[model samples]
Target: MSPERGRPPRRAVVRAARRGLGYMPGTLLIAAVAGVLGLSLGAGGVPDVVPAGGGLTVNDVTSKAFGQHAPGLPIGELRHFTIGNRLFNTNWVIAPASVRSLDGLGPYFNRVSCSACHVRDGRGRPPAGPEAPMMSMLVRLSVPGPDGTPAAHPIYGEQLSDRAVEGLAPEGRAAMTWEPLAPFVYADGSVVPLRRPRLDFVDMADGPLGPGAMTSARVANAVFGLGLLEAVSEAHVVARADPDDANGDGVSGRVNRVWDHDAQALALGRFGWKANQPTLRQQAAAAMAGDVGVTSEHFAGGNYTAAQTDAAALPNGADDEGVELSRKQLNRLTFYLQTLAVPARRDTHNPVVQRGEQLFGAAGCNACHTPVMQTGATAAHGVLVDQTFAPYTDLLLHDMGPGLADGRPDGLASGREWRTPALWGLGLQKRVSGHTFLLHDGRARNAQEAVLWHGGEARGARDRFARWPAEDRAALLAFLDSL
Candidate 1:
């Protein structure tokens, strides 16, 4: 239910009151008492507080809209959303151990849970305290092949696992640093600095990391509304592809078709910056298996070596084999991701915000970060359609300049290319969420930093932003946050 945008029934109410006033005071009081008693007894229902034919204020519309879609989710389906929240919370701060049964936990991995990096399921900012600057966020790096393609390392390789068994600590610790660059002053006099990210990791003390070792780094992303991204049809994305840059805009869009184990074929990539993983299901499975080292039927073989496998050393019940996640649990996780609602916009009508929106369009930011695509009708979740989604991403890979490049390619994303991330959740970032680490390397500590770090095809826009006036620049940022 969208808001009621029609006229109010004020005249009708006024006439009804006039007639009621003519009734004796005693009779009116008795009638009012009877109405209260009926409501207490759960008669038909409480008359609509909003009242029929009434003009809906913004608050009324929002409260009602929220109740219809979220706050008052229909029964039965509530489990899907609620269970999704639980799984999210579980994965948020606590990692699933590689070898866990009903008894307990595992062999090898990185941090315990998703929240370790993402923190409050929001954005991750810069490294502070004792944590190394590289510790601002973890990047997953795999070595490149002779052809320059990213491939898993042969042995004593793959992603660096920092946690291992009882006696042995995990091998491979990545240490990184940040070097800030000069602030670029925009046309409007707004200035923002850029950040350069550098990485170095140590291999196992007892062993040697082979030549084919592959590396990739991941800055944690908020898991809000990912399901919508996943649900967006391949046809819609492929149609947006301007592979040859035929539009003459120099911005060519392409889909990252990747291996899909569930579908048992190649499918459109939607999740990662590379679009490397096909679905939320595959992404979650890999995260569980690779990041936390928890093996499941989805990733049966696991991404580690015998020397690297933790169960043998740590001594936990073997969840990798018999105790795997059920389809229900997996689906719940996906559902929660899909339904994680975008936060309500603040001050969308502010003049600054309106101007910023217009400037955003003029700035060509919308060329790639295209906005407003209506979700098609669906039986299970009607909320997908007509639901204003502000994911300011075309979900296609783009050649960001050298400044933003991590030099580690994955599937379809070249070292210079990455899938556009959604910008809708910025309003709550590092607030209800935490950290403002933007971009793949987590080097850009804030929005301005991220913008300043843009390069390659975005260089022109970056330059433009560098010269934007302070007030206009504030409007631009305001526009971004209003997403």
Candidate 2:
């Protein structure tokens, strides 16, 4: 698969120009002139930014946009991708059943399948009200360990599983109620409503969670273009680390070193809310074990804690190799994630969007949301290797201040720290997921609110954005919408 396989064709650009040449920026006009003269725009600093995912990009602006396979997937790997898609959407049942392949659901789990949380392979949101259950979200549980690191709650383990298989009691039900904060008034007198989530546990099957147990509520993140992210070199990630702010940029991003289960050693953290998981494969295995209660090669045992004897003693759906999901199945699932396409950016030539892009860079948002990163030569797939993709994240941990802090440490990430999420799909979230809820906890209602919630290292950028003219703010949002 060539790196240019899915780029927007010349005709697509012509169509965009024809829609309204009046709305085109001068830079875009220059590009049009360059195109007519058979001149390349690369030398003039006019970026060819339409293909957001490099060769893996797909042009689709509909609800099904996030679920596409990466452009130019090999015929041989297509079978594995199809099988992985099935496994992701398949709902496992209770153990010792006829369909052994789809068994071993849970003694305790949050959702039955990966698609249950990440519906359509897009983002998940919190429940609309307290009357609703957490359909596409979950709550993590832990307490202070002897060395002050986070340890699993003696009974609840690492995650709170709200659902269980037949004849077994679930850990508990996770609920949330929103507390409306004072509306943020911008310099231009525009106000954006803000709300914070208040997580509560009810219907505890065992006993009360003792005092000082920490909990974090998280919505399921979109899973597309992960293969490209996984292919980004550790050296590239480490080169961006500025843990001490030695350059005085006020943006001190630090790598979160975590245990790589496959390597059995500490490695550069890349995926997850806290950048806690080292690889996409490990992240998939962990989700299967923690969210679906399905054991994989990485997590061969059930998710039950020693204290949960009833859950542990129950008949599991382990196969001949003593694991619910075999190595081949896990590999297929990982490959599926590795090949999911990233939607191409929209409205790249729109004048407002161009201004917003400029404003985004001017406000230093790019400091954390680095627009482009080159993948290493080696990847799970040939298409993902040596590609320049725009994921818009540093994948480093930064202190987000007290307002957004869960007060729950994850690996080397402190309670105030959170991994910077990619901004590539920010524009199409509403079309794909039906909701605009964002952030690790889904407290922010939209991108603007999400920006307002930023603190700590990002406070400078947030403050700059807060002080922008309303039109500039709108343009910035427009640019994000075009992403």
Candidate 3:
């Protein structure tokens, strides 16, 4: 008999029960064994299952799950969290509105609010088709510059904004067309079709994006667990760096050191698709400048290039107050992002999930999708201090091969490198954001497709997945879903 996609075989269930019941009292163990065998247990005979998120995880599975505050936030900080939530969800308008706080949107920008891209604190998907406009995703533009840094495109600057304020033309619109490739065959004769994206720039206001410009398509990632990722000790993350692959494990992970605006020095980057932003505060500030066309203390000037003189000349709301986003407001939004809770893993006790967990490690997925890390003392938020979390990422950049390359270098990350994304809330992405697209650009249609796209350092793990029997493949996916 074959195991169901999400249900483990009966034998697997029995094995899991025996293993989990070792410390149970005699009567409880007997009843657990009976339950595993499908014997009816009387009232009060059920065993207590351990919850996921290791106490930090929330059990909500609804669309609103990602928007919740972290469990156990101090009572005193609740008001601040609520204020931040309102600010995060507030839509910024063109400058000089009745409401002073929510004004100063872009003279040139992508979306009006942070929630526009994150979409309920969840992932963003690519455009549905060629006619679809890019709303939640943006294209990063750069060229090779001095000291291994990326030079902003002379005309477009760092990002291409497809929308602009009244009377001003947008830089350009971004469109995508997909080209299908030959179907990939597995060892067991199963096949998977793959598609690659072709990005097109249309209606350029300044002129042609010079042939030398390098572009990377980036989809907005989920906002949960960021504070925890931020809380991870720099020394601990650095300790995992193996840029030279000294162990010959076929995996070489490198650290991305970037400018920390508050620290006023170079610091290890742990945010963004390429790990280009050093801290969440700076990440928020960059988003304000680049995504919303709003200026803050970190980016006092609007995101306009010298070529965008028209945009630069626009009356920035900041001229009245000196900056668009105030220090208090920025801190509130940052706090809101820092406190979003990680959704608890569902169906963790199921036998199929257990089997999948074992297979995950066996396939060498753990080599880069590191399953565990401990948070050190976090000065930004006390809620994240000294917590052990399973974010399932090393937060280091790895060469994912030409298959997923954007041909754009960011900070120290090569064209083919991307920071390992956290897998904690992956299963709920479709539920929260209404899409299952994965990868940096939301190219992969599902987790399976995401795995098939892996290459370079992850070639061995990808091959292991490809070579697995259909049942094992289902098991592996089930394990990931449980997370």
**Highest TM-score among the candidates is held by which one?**
2
TM-scores, all models, native as reference: 0.77, 0.91, 0.90
List, residue by residue over 1-483, the lDDT tens digit for candidate 3.
112344657886665545434446546654644443233444555434323344467888999878888888888788788998888778999988888777889989999999999999888889977789997999999977776578998888999999999989999988899889888888878787788889988999988897778999999999987888888899999999999999999998999999898999999999999999988889999999999988999899888887778888787777455999999889988888888888888876666665566566667787788777778866477777887667888999999999999989888899999999988877777789988888998888888888999999999999987886676787778878777
Q: Tens digits of per-residue lDDT for model 2 on 225-326?
A: 888989999999999999999999999999999999899999999988999899989999999999999998889889999898898889999999899988
Q: How accurate is candidate 2 locally (lDDT)?
A: 0.85
Q: Rank order by lDDT, top first? A: 2, 3, 1
Question: Number of the top candidate by lDDT?
Answer: 2
lDDT of each: 0.58, 0.85, 0.82
Q: Tell me the tens digit of each residue's lDDT in model 1 across 1-483.
A: 001112225564344334333444533433443343221212332111211101101122231221111433457767887775565445322124442332222355665555555454555554542235333245565677678766666554456666654566666566656666786655545455665655566655446565555466666666656656766677878888887889887688778888898989989988876778888778887776666655556866544666554444444333435434445666776665555555555666555554555456545676677654334445125545434344678888888877677667778777788888877656556554444567776676667777777677666676665565455556677767655
Candidate with better TM-score, 1 vs 2:
2
Q: List candidate 1 segments past 4 Å from native.
A: 1-72, 91-105, 129-136, 146-148, 186-191, 203-214, 306-323, 378-382, 385-388
Counting clashing residue pairs in each candidate, in order, gives 32, 0, 0
lDDT of 1 at 398: 85
RMSD of 3: 6.0
